[model samples]
Target: MRRAPTQKRSRDRVENILKAACELISASGSDTMKMGELAEKAGVSIGSLYQYFPDKASIIHALAERYNEESQHCLDEALADVTTQSGLIAAFDQLIDTYYDLFLAEPVICDIWTGTQADKTLRDMELEVSRANAQSLVRTILRLRDNDGDGATFAARCLLIMYTGEATMRLAISVPASEGREIISSYKRMMGRELSEMLQV
Candidate 1:
């Protein structure tokens, strides 16, 4: 945002603007959404919209950040109960399935993720989210058994797992429903096998 919305009303207005942007993006995508269109949809003046978001990219950034935070919450929740090998596998599958559902529920997020490809800040933010998730995975593994002798290697594998999950989820969203389910099932089985192995010394 160009300026933070500090007051209650200001904050609400910004949220309304972002909500409007999300609707517009979901309908036609970010490439075609205009500021005037968003301002009208948000029931705010173009000037007010600009006050919070300097441009369309800023609005997408805000949306992406919001979605990323929500995803982190999902990751935290899904991994919270991970203990034994079966529990960890279940948690991992649950995390992937939950995010897959979230993406299907919120179509705008797919556009926001695609938008991240061209923007460095958004890309960096995405990497941070992955790293944080990997840390959670690493913590779970530490309580289990030594998958790799070094923490760094274990964390690196966790990061790769996160990246693979992310890719599969995105791909799953783009394919037909049946194909998507199969993709998710296959990935879950693979990850489950890997995670189950990690639990053993």
Candidate 2:
């Protein structure tokens, strides 16, 4: 027997608080995320905020988790069409395009991730998530190599650093979107040649 269609899970009040906190943080930054303001915006009591997260740091960490999970989902979907180097290149390009699109699509959210201030916990969480993403992209690149051996691991590590560095550079500077696309293309071309050599293709 088929079950009736179920509605999506309604977000809890704590979730609403976290969402409000992130929006406020992105707009004005971590310094502006006052608990009082957050509680007011989330339509919850200060005690309720504490019930979910003892401090702002905990709230930011939860936001980071949500961001990374969403990004991972997009990347996984982008790579699904990959099957060869050319296909991989196309997939990588799509992945990058999707990433930048996401960033521009919501500058506020990107600011939350990219902002630098009294956010030691959020910064650490961001680095940890980014490292995992770099490693995953690298592993996929190595698998698509025309020639490979045990050395693929080293090559994967190198690709991870290069690709991640490129992405970081793009984020750091305020280049026009078109120029940014050119930069990414150049980086990809260079990395492709370099990877081809490393794999001795």
Candidate 3:
């Protein structure tokens, strides 16, 4: 027997609802999103919204998944050939350059990407993405030194913190790209010096 056509329409409507939610979330902060507005933007009924998502958190969770997929693709491409120490450092710098450029290209979307969820479910999803990024970075650091898992992990976390802080700072202060490059270069130099010391120990 064939399934009901209404079922297919229901799924399509859910997808449309989520898409509209993401667009609205990008324009305004996630906290500012309204259900009525989302229904109007998606051309769906509030009842239909309940049929798909229990609350705004579900829609936001879906958006998080969408953001993660896009970010994973970009990061994969950025780190695809980082096999050597120098290549890893170059990739690290290039990753920062590429990521900052991407984020600056869409500040609103970047804000959406940076959005957080208060619930544990949403936090868990983001945590998985964070852990995956840390693991990838740690692997790259390992190529620079062996038998130092603890140091590699520490380096990855430190670099991630530094990179994220610098990106946000540059955005907040509207720092020029040339100056930002210098700042990032200095960070790379410091990281190299730290790694040298770690290796010597």
RMSD of each: 1.9, 6.2, 5.5
lDDT of 3 at 64: 63
Ranked candidates, highest lDDT first = 1, 2, 3
What TM-score, computed on C-alpha atoms, does each candidate reach? 0.92, 0.73, 0.66
In candidate 2, residue 100 scores what lDDT? 68
lDDT of 2 at 16: 76
Off by over 4 Å in 2: 1-11, 116-120, 145-147, 155-159, 162-179, 195-201
> For residues 1-201, could you state the per-residue lDDT of candidate 3 as single tens digits?
011125777768777887787688668767888888999999988877776677777677766677667876766676666656566657656766665676667544455445544467755765677666656566556645564557555656645654454345345335677776676667667666654444342
Q: After superposition, how far is residue 122 of candidate 1 from its true place, in Å?
A: 2.6
Question: TM-score of predicted model 1?
Answer: 0.92
Q: In model 3, what lDDT does residue 55 have?
A: 74
- After TM-score superposition, the amount by which residue 155's alpha carbon in candidate 2 deviates from its true location, in angstroms, is 6.0
- Clash totals in order: 0, 0, 0
Query: Is 1 or 2 the stronger prediction by TM-score?
Result: 1
- Please state the error at residue 153 of candidate 3 in Å: 4.6
The TM-score of predicted model 3 comes to: 0.66
